[model samples]
Target: MSNGQGMATEGEVQEGLTVEEIAFIHGHLHDNVGELILKAGKFKGLDVKKLAAQIQSRQKALKKLPEWSTNEKLIFPPALSVEQCSSEATAHYKASIVSGDRLIDITGGMGIDCYYMSRSFTDTHYFEQQPEVASTAAYNFTQLGATRIHVHAGESLHALHDGLNADWLYADPARRDANKEKVVRLADCTPDVAGNAALLLNAAPHILIKTSPLLDIDLASKELQKLKEVHVIGYEQECKELLFVLDREMPEQDFKIKVRMIDAAGQPIHELDFDREEERSAVVSYAKPLGYLYEPHAAVLKAGAFKTLCTRFNVQKLAMHSQLYTSEEYVNDFPGRSFRIVAVCKPDIREISQHIPGDKANITARNFPAKPEELRKKWKLKDGGDHYLFATTLADQSKVVIVCVKPI
Candidate 1:
């Protein structure tokens, strides 16, 4: 809720408060958090300001991660700290990737990733620049009954200069600048994971770097060397994080990009991997909208998988650039939503009105001249119901509106 990094005095865990007092603070943090400082002036023996900060952090984290939110003993930093932490789902995905003897998190914020990542490894080192955050992480780890994580409060680079080696060295750089503005480029992120690639590679055989979901995958591969694989992770069909895993001994040319979706309807996981050459050389058929419409998952789209998607699904691309796909038969296991074509007509109100048989319909545009808002106004249609309209361009260079309906 609150954006500012409010009081972080929770770093002094159990120092001034007794067990009963800490228990009281945790009990009211759920509902009475806002009123505690206002009415009581002090929540038991805990600082009211600190209690408020913890409540705000916990409330925000609850939506993103219910596991951490329900933990009564978990110590959270200010709003900014919890805001930047990874969701439990994404962190669990990252932890599933590597399993070894040791792990070192170069940039630990709320330590959500490390908290899960440490489970796979026998030993883990969490390094954070902020003392309060680091102390909070240490306290939280203990509360979670962790026994292997070694919390280090300082710069991770300085700690790694001693030639420490591990199975994995991970870094999720701070994407914000001094002005609190977002830094889109990898080089701009604090700790400069791309700039100090050589040093990081030397610290571990495998290095995992998490970047913003908007980061260009191709550009990042060029910026960093010894690439092993790039993971595009999504949750509930929405792309969230871009993970790059670099192997010290691996060659750059022999790398693959794996696009993973956490939820694919009833299926638990959906994954597709392709190399640069394969994607470049892939030949996908193109055709007009025939029997059904297929849309790739969000993670697949983010992986620059326009061409390769059609090849994998054995479908035809609507156009060279347009990501819409079509096939003569139904694809039972298609990764995305499937819609059967009801009617394909030109962008004429007379034809659309006659066939609609409904008051409102959902609209989608692919490779069209006008945006959704402009087209909605021009089409004179309401926005609701199960009906769907697709305004797109065909391969023959014709702009048409295709009426698509969900399969019952």
Candidate 2:
């Protein structure tokens, strides 16, 4: 498989291949083994048509591997998985700056989001700390005919500190710890939120920070002064990451705080509105679960509209467990599905150990101050069960347990 210009050699076919060759392989190879061989044989120029035929021939004898797909239908780079790409795309789309002429992405991982957002801006600057990633991005941009884009390899904060100006700054901070552990909170990462925020906000009028799905929105919002928007994204009702936007210049009237959960097609699955003047306390309380239970969408939870949600759904709060609410009437128009509470307990370890006498149990602890894994371990519970035990805290500072099942 050699071309005229130093194309096909044994080493090239066996080990070294250019990115263009890899892209060809990705498009033609159907199986993981074929993909691996093509990746290994990178230096050589593999025939795309031949590889496709080879893949078709090999498929007859090979066992099928698990195929991975996402509800978001996001297309990812070969280096990243579909889930990661979908998540990054959703966050970038939601945090997009429509008013910006020039945009700067401080941490462009695979150039997926950068490619999508660059369409709205006149010019785009993408910075990647890793040399390989930066090179890949440069090649990809050139191949895509994106002449107005520049890919730089260096530290983002240092580059920003050197005086880069843009209408918007987007950053995805490294959330990995020193021990190579994944951390969810702002305090967990290197150059923490404050440090990154200082550099990012200094470069642009608006900065968008993408955070973990497990992060505490209240805590994150409290940490950033100019935080104007918080979004909790979801794909097909499954909660994903939380996005925070901080604006340097305030609008004439503060934009109403919005909580939006979007689907794979970039449609709003659920939305909740909040203002600076809205109260965070629990609102109206209805009688115990009568016909249905309404769980607010992620955006609603991020907005901390416990009272507003309850009022909107005509539900009652289950004390202080802000994660859940109860109602008697069936509100078909509610964003979240309705569930029925079958039982409630005090969540005493002794009571739980004594009352539950089964080989399998489904344990979920929310706002009750106990970790789910710890509770599951302590209770010796297993999965694949119909019952859901909710260990949550009440407004009275009391820990309680509620057993629930999906409503018919």
Candidate 3:
């Protein structure tokens, strides 16, 4: 199954490639190669090495598919364009459908957000600083079937200061400096959030700003007034991004925070909300630590609703130091999964070795002095297990041990 140039031809690639092979190619392909392969056909097996070899052989030819031509207007490769559009579109779609008319995208990166929102609104305005990015966006939008979008190729604040009116203002500032240093906070960007607030406030009745997940939520909430909702999106329990929605017309009520998890099927698996008062630790014991330990999601942690969660689950916090809660019988319908306590030992390696002499052990250290991986190495533990051991501090501020194993 090979093409004339030592690569697989369209027919051969489709016939020979596995799902995993296609995924690898999808991940590594350049815009041109990706466009060629996708148009050739979808691959459906697991021969990644063979697919890589094919791609390597055809690298030169693939480069000739089409450069990002502003005039010719070829199809934007799904690999390059779709990845960006998926994230951008999700944000734009969410904002557009949330009861709004006019939309102002302040930091229009590639214009994918603007492209999608254009369909849902009567007018859509996009602002971008880089000339190349702006041009690329213009071209990309045309390729994506968007013709009516207005691109403001300049500084976002400048465009905003020029008196743009919109029902919803969207901004995704450049979080990287010229030297490629990552900007972790609003203050680190070129036009800091504070500096651009006035312009944003005047531009629209509501503003939706996308910030790095690394930014401290507490600091961001405090700095951005009129912030009504904080959303943390996670995939398969791994946190991805944070969204802050600010509304100028509405007075500040109790802060509402939502944590959402989307599964591979594109369905929301979980959506939990916390009100202002629920974000506090409580003083009651819901239930005693049984055989399992459960750690809630990051949004739960951020909401600080340990008491509420404990009360709802009928569980008790393992200890003051441990953020995880424990219950005796298995709560099959728990929001977060549950794990059974398999083994428990002190932080001392000698003691740990005595309890579990195997070469592999799963180690988790929370509220303990040592890091998890470091302790794993110190105890000469390899990784393989349904077994989980936690080194933490008890409610009385005493060092304690926790061992977890899921019930069958």
Pick the lDDT winner. 1
RMSD each, Å: 5.0, 8.8, 10.5
TM-score of 1: 0.86
lDDT of 2 by residue, 233-314 (tens): 6655556666777888755334455666665445675676666456445456634334455566655665567677765666
Candidate 1 lDDT, 283-345, residue by residue in tens = 988899999998777888888888887778888988887788899989766666789989898
Cand. 2 TM to true fold = 0.65
- TM-score of every model? 0.86, 0.65, 0.70
Q: Arrange candidates by TM-score, highest first: which order?
A: 1, 3, 2
Output the lDDT of residue 382, model 1: 85
lDDT of 3: 0.61
Best by TM-score: 1
Q: How many pairs of residues in model 1 come into backbone collision?
A: 0
**Cα lDDT, all candidates:** 0.79, 0.60, 0.61
Model 2 whole-model lDDT (C-alpha atoms): 0.60
Clashing pairs in 1: none
39 Cα displacement, candidate 3 (Å): 26
